[model samples]
Target chain A: MPQLDPTSFSPQLFWLAIAFILLYLLMSRLVLPRVGKVLGQREERIQGNLEKAVKLKAEAEEVLAAYQKSIADARAEAHSALNQAAAEIAAATAAREADFARKLAEQTAVAESRIKVSKTQALADIRTVAGDLAAAMTSKLTGVTVNGSDAGGAVEAVLKERA
Target chain B: MAAEHHSPLEQFRVEHIGGNLSLGGYDISFNNSALWMLIAVAAITVFMLVGIRKQAVVPGRWQALVEFLYDFVANMLKENVGNEGRKYFPWVFSIFMFVLFCNLFGLLPNSFTVTSHIIVTFALALMVFIIVTAIGFIRHGLHFLSFFVPKGAPAWLLPLMIPIEIISYFIRPMSLSVRLFANMVAGHVMLVVLGSFVLPLGLAGAYISGIVPVAAITAIIGLEFLIACLQAYVFTILTCIYLNDAVHMNH
Candidate 1:
């Protein structure tokens, strides 16, 4: 076989050494660092992206929590305001009703006093009429006359006895 | 129809190229073998350099291929030789790429296989042997000598076992080189002999004999392609294993 030729061995070895050393130097010096850098940068970028995503997610959750808390607070405030308005309306209505009742009682007391005075005046006029009727009838039948003041005393005696 | 009946072995011939100029009285002439070696080196360089020109974060196809090969070699060393093997990446990666590209390129028609020669394979194996032994000695001092002495043998059998161990250790390079050379030679010889039969037989008669060789060459070419990849892998892994032995010295 031509491969067994001793003369060809040296050239093959020489070339092999050159090719191999050239490849080794190229890989070690230029190619290895570039490739390693690309791979390393890629890893770092992916890691950074993932961390950013996590941070954004946490921020989003925090905002959601705050939003929900504000909603609950606003609802509570509205509820309390509603209750306070209802209580104020109830107090105003009660005070208005109490004032109307006190005014009605005072008007009722004034009407009662006027009604008593009218009743006393009506009794005195009746007593005068009765005393004149008695004096007229006695004068016509037996020629006798009586005063209103005496008649009023006699009527008051009769009203007291009846009461 | 008559045609040249070429010798199947004629394909292995080494011819001088460009009127070979020697230097310092050594016949280091430029030949077909040297030309192919340069092509292999060029191919490797382009595959690496141009493949990463973009160096995109999301890699293109060529960049992915480059990274894949890099990771493959890196992982091979990591598994076989551990972290201590990191320093030897350049040598290991270079040899792996060299042998792989040479073997693959040889499969092309009219291409010279660089690894098919015993001299080339022997030189590579010898280098690996020397480097591994040097590492062994440097790491363990005289304890590397104890590598050839078995631990569990009886006192009487120690003499026989030690010599056997020494012989085995020395045979590593021979075995490594011969295995690669013989495999390449055998596969190529088979393909050439079968290939020679195809065109002539097809034109000679109405018989289907040519089809048989065609089918066979097809199958064998596929097998040879697989062998090309396998041999390169085997060579690299073996280098890693030997390096492992030197670094860790379990036996």
Candidate 2:
């Protein structure tokens, strides 16, 4: 086989060097930046999503707390209203009962007074009729003048003897 | 193997130059290897320039094909190097394209495989080694030397450890060049030897014997084509890994 050596400082090394430099430039200036940009974009997107999730979670917790508080306030208000209504009903019923009892007592007292006045008037009318009958009998029998007072006393004495 | 006819290597033989020029030291004789190298370089330049000359948004077939290769190498760099290390894409891309073109050009009928030569492959490997080393030193200086030292080794094992590191470092270029050259040479030789047998076997035997050599040649040629692409890929990827080691020094 023949020896396979090239002359030193040939165009071969120059071409190789040129190619290497060109390759290095293309990589550094063009290709590398695109790749790096893509990766950086991806990382930013992931981090943004994470932060959004955290914010949403905080907002949800706040809403839940507010809802719970409102429900508790409503329940307390309902209980207070129910208590007030019950107390009002009890007071009204007690007042009605007291009024009814007072009216009944006044009606009973008026009836009892009317019965006593009627009985007194009836007894007075009976006494006058008896006195008139005594006076007429004394005048006829004695054929003499008799006083009104003497007649009245004789009638009362006769009635007492008959009882 | 037979004296009846010539071998395929005959075409690649170096002939003596009888020119009167006093360029004594200059081996003005052109061989198969040099022809293929020029062809590879031309093929790459023409393919890329022609493919993107139109610069169409919706690219043609040639443009699409070229673009695919571009994107492929770009993605390979990004995947290996990560975000911070993506700055070296141009160097990696050019290496991949040039090597790929060289390997593919050799696959053509009667074309020489320059990568099959150890000197050519060594030059490629040497460039990678030198560039990566320089980059490492520039980036980390003496700190880059720490890449050779294993973190978990015992103090007593420094003697064994240091030698292993040195050997491993030296073997990088050797392994890188040899792997490419050997694979390319072996594939080409197999195809040529098998193809030569086809003609000799055809003339000496019955017509039916032609089928065997034909089938074998076809299979070997197909495998060679595949290998051409694979060897280029292997060469490019290894260079990337070596560059990564220099840049990051992860170990």
Candidate 3:
């Protein structure tokens, strides 16, 4: 085989050396750097994206917390408002009931006073009538005129004894 | 016509271009091997230059291919040589690309396989051997001599084991170079031998008798392509391993 032949060895080695060194320089100085730079840039971009995602997630959580806080505040406000409304209604009902009771009591007192006045008037009429009757009867029996004032005094004394 | 040139070995002949040129005693004349080497270098240079010209953050197809090769070599170095191997990335990468391209280009019609030549492979292997040995001595100083001493060997076994270790250590270049050269030579020889049958059979004879060799040639070509890539990988990883031994000084 010509490959086994010794004559071709030196030229092949010389060219191999030159080409290899040149290729090494090209790759190390130029090609590899460019490729490495691009890869590094991609890695940096992905890392930055991940960091942004985390930051955005934190911001979303903060917003969600604020939203939850507002909901709770509104719920508390609604509860207090409901409680205040309930208390006002209760107070109004109590005040209305108290006014109603006061007015009813005043009417009862007026009615009782009217009944007392009527009762006293009725007793006085009865007393006058009895006194008149007694004077008439006494005058008729005795065939003489009886004094009204004396009859009234005798009726009053009899009524007081009966009581 | 085919019977006249039946030697498959003829394909490996390195004919000098433009007569022989010698500088002092050295035969520095440009030859077929040199020409192919230049072609391989130019091809790689162009491929790299065009692929990386854009340097896009989002890589185009060519740029992606270039990046893929770069990362492949980088990862190989990192895996075999560790982080300290980062400094040797360019050399390892160059060797891998050069061997790979040379092997592939040799597959073309009438092209020379530079790696098939023992001299070329030996040169590469020798360079790696020298670099690794220098690194070993530089890192470990006189302790580098201890590399030939097997750990856990009894004092009486020293005489037996020491020579074996030393010989094995010295044989690294020969093994590395021969492994690549032999694989290339064998594959190319098979291809040429099988291919030689095709022309001799003629068209009518090919229909009658050439089917087997043709099919074999096709299959062997595919296998050769695989071997080309694998051999390149093997050569590079072995270099990394040797470098690792140097750096770590592990027996």
* Pick by TM-score: 1 or 3, better one: 3
Could you give candidate 1's per-residue lDDT for residues A45-126 as a string of tens digits?
9999999999999999999999999999999999999999999999999999999999999999999999999998998778
For model 2 chain B, the run of ten residues with the poorest summed lDDT: B14-23
In candidate 2, position A129 carries an lDDT of 65
lDDT of 3 by residue, A1-163 (tens): 7877777777777778888888888888987787788889889998999999999999999999999999999999999999999999999999999999999999999999999999999988877888888989988898777787788888999988999
- Residue range B10-99, candidate 1, lDDT tens digits: 767788987766768778889998899889888888888898889799999999999999899999999999999999998899999999
Steric collisions counted per model: 0, 1, 0
Q: Estimate, for each residue in B1-251, the C-alpha lDDT of model 3 and write its tens digit.
A: 57536687777889999888776687878999999998998898889889988878788999989989989999999998899999988889999999999999999989999899999999999999999999999989989999899999999999999999999999999999999999999999898888877766646573667777889999999999999999999999999999999998775
Off by over 4 Å in 2: A1-163, B1-5, B11-32, B54-60
Interface RMSD of each: 1.0, 6.0, 1.1
lDDT of each: 0.89, 0.70, 0.89
RMSD of each: 5.3, 8.3, 3.9
lDDT of 2 by residue, B100-167 (tens): 77777778776656666666677888888998889999999999988888789998998899889979
lDDT: worst 10-residue window of model 3 chain A: A4-13
Place model 1 in a CAPRI quality band: medium
Which segments of model 1 are wrong by more than 4 Å? Answer: A61-163, B1-5, B20-25, B150-157
